[model samples]
Target: MFQPWLATLLIWIPTLVTAGDPAETPWISLKPENHNGKHIVFVTGDEEYRSEEGMPQLAKILSKHHGFHCTVLFSIDAENGCIDPGVLDNIPGLKALDDADLLVLFTRFRNLPDEQMKHIADFVESGKPVIGLRTSTHAFDIPNDRKYHRWSFRNDQWKDGFGRQIMGETWIAHHGGHGWQSTSGIIPADMKQHPIVRGINDGEIWDPSDVYTVRLPLPDGCIPVVMGRVLSGMNPEDGPCEPEERDGKTFDKNNPIMPLAWVRELKGSSGKTQRVFSTTMGASQAFTREGSRRLLVQACYWCLGMEEKIDGKGNVSIVGKFKPTSFGFNSHTKNVRPKDLLD
Candidate 1:
């Protein structure tokens, strides 16, 4: 039912840009450019859970080709898909989370409420810098509240609440069902120089959801960059299935394998360091290839360090087009260029 003039023409079609027209626009407003700092990006999801997938076109392509200063918090009411109403009084104050440097969780099974889950656990313990995509590691589930019952990894107080010490692990299950493969081709040779895997090569097979398997054990000095190979499936809300086995063929038993992406460090017992970057797989729109949208826009520009602001001079277009309202929920608007939606 969301069609407020296509969400106000997809929030003003990024803000048209046609000087020489290289074509890679989408930054409607939030000024502050020349950015080497000030990264603020908070985009929640669950547009009716899976209403055709697009998550505000990946938050308008990370605030228009990565200059990032975005703020798109939306749970859209969340119901049978598990509640999430406006993440704590519709967060976005505190001078915009103290001019947030980064935080891009993409919700899916949220159920917030306990004073908005302690204001999202005190805004991820205030350490800052996070980028969990795909079901945001079981987002947030309040079985009956009880302070949010460990957030969910099947439950058992998994990570001891607050989204497993801030997204180290929570929702495990994906034995590779969507398609494609090849992960972590063993890149940890001192992180291949890091900087988010420089350019990222070795095998390369982006665009294909569902890939997890890092049980739990990251947030300490966390830094595992990328590790692949385990893919099976099963997490479509985990229900109705059959066929199982692990080291002996016969998969599909509701697919339950793991580890699709990683990069962490959240020490914080008060020490404070935070900086996470998980990825069970981009919340499907059918993989949006281009190496899965440049591996989720280079893992959100290396968890907000900006990774030199990536613009290698090619491929970065994602203009606008969301359409999917049958009540399922999907209306990111549709401004191809109506004067860039009246910018």
Candidate 2:
């Protein structure tokens, strides 16, 4: 089904400029000459985690390795036009989704303007593929007056909004200790044969970020792909710890631990079932490990309906020198632009 608008998008083939603006938002784009004709648009924003850095690294691998054209949109401080994740209001260049085949979202508590958010809503309504990571489960934190307030992590209209209704889970409590504990990916017995975990080893999938507490049985027909094992330390060799008993309840860490990565089918407003891939394991430091990188790469292929191209050996080698900053509040590199990330 060739959409008329999609045909026009192919003609432009790039992120268009916003002229006459003094402090225009900076965007990063990579369109390979030998392209796969598919565009993956990454939306990065968050105060705590370094999603700004993680988005670019994922985009580079998808563009440079898999031959897919990728565009990364960052949260910019409009006053100076520099990347600023703490500025939760503005995220320009979402119009790039007009041509995007997939939307890889990594935002947290974003309350974008109607003009900007319409692009994402339109994309979701169009039934396109979507991939979200980490804080994306609670991506939007809109006010009650706004039209897209229903898209927030907690909402009465849609009941837990996009994350629960569409992506799987909303902002839930952390299963492990916030900064003290680490997590290692443990492939579920049922998910071992799944393509997303095909090339990934159980112990290989580890991250410094703790495991998120999701509902035992995920909503919206989600299949649990990887479970996070709360580690005693940050190292991959760290020993697994049992879920602690807090107050009257016990946080289940080892005995049927919480899910770290999974997939969902979002039944959108367009009456289309959109393919959605989400994970809680995409912190910048997590990408340093080969297993974590391969898990995400495989999910991309699966989301785009190109599972046959997975190759199984998990050839997800890092594209270049990747040294991501540790996740924290206002932890992003200051006074930087999108294009400057490559240099």
Candidate 3:
């Protein structure tokens, strides 16, 4: 008779070793056929708006449909190795950024250690392209005394940190009513022919997340691509917002829509100008719409200087079943590891 307990122990030891090993940073990587020879790394750690849930879905689309190698790194619980967006400090597998051609960042208020942050800093300094989604504008909240404090969203020296210096804006107040209003995309008249908005039509893109306020005219070298019309309700068929008194002034939200999406050409420390795509709407619920998914897919091609290759009606179908958790604070699904998404 074989000893069942002894056999189980031997089988379990290897699994324990791999999970406990510090060298093995937990992450999910998706490889694509018909390789485009580019690697896109996604950093997801936002508490609300569900970057943790959305980034992976986006990565899968990029890989399975577009032929880019996509890797998604999430904030992990130290004690149990589960994906935990509430953990504001640690996001393992950032070293993947070293070889990344483009970075899709959606972190909010992260205060990672210097060693982990150095990887992101080095990548940004390399003059590579970047895509900033929703809360990424206010991504870091490092203390003033920290080594990478300049990246903090509220730093005096850096002047709004990476969001302002690189992505063209930082955390301003919500332009639309947070939960009550929705955002409808409008292609700027001048930008209708732009490659990024190639296949998308006005009003096709809608997100439940409200528009964020950005200072007027945007910054130098930034071009607005999509304007967001504030809607009266969360449904796509909802009417445009009515005139209301706000900030002691009468305002009509739809008259002058906010910049929903834009592109920037910023000079990095390496003396090279890199392309950046920033969109104020990328909540997990946003991608449920076909227009929202198409816009992002095309933007990735545009960022990589492959704009000419974008198919106006390319396949942006969901890779597999994707039922994302609703956007909220402290509502992330617990005990779920990055590896769990491999299925």
Tens digit of per-residue lDDT, candidate 1, span 110-180: 66556555655556677777777656767766675576667653566555344455666665565444343
Sort order, lDDT high to low: 3, 2, 1
Instruction: Score candidate 3 by lDDT.
Output: 0.87
Q: Please give the ranking of all candidate structures by TM-score, highest first, separated by commas.
A: 3, 2, 1
TM-scores, all models, native as reference: 0.31, 0.90, 0.91
How displaced is residue 219 in candidate 2, in Å? 0.9
The parts of candidate 1 lying over 4 Å away from their true place are 1-56, 61-68, 71-100, 103-128, 132-174, 178-208, 216-240, 245-265, 268-271, 275-277, 283-319, 323-343
lDDT of 2 by residue, 245-311 (tens): 7798996567777888888776767887788888987778888888888888888889898888777
Better of 1 and 2 by lDDT: 2
Best by TM-score: 3
Candidate that beats the other on lDDT, 1 or 3, i.e. the better one: 3
The C-alpha RMSD of each candidate to the native structure, in angstroms, is 19.8, 7.0, 6.4
Candidate 2: where is the Cα deviation over 4 Å?
Answer: 1-25, 243-252
Model 3 CA deviation exceeding 4 Å by range: 1-25, 247-249
- Candidate 2 is scored at a TM of 0.90
- TM-score of model number 1: 0.31
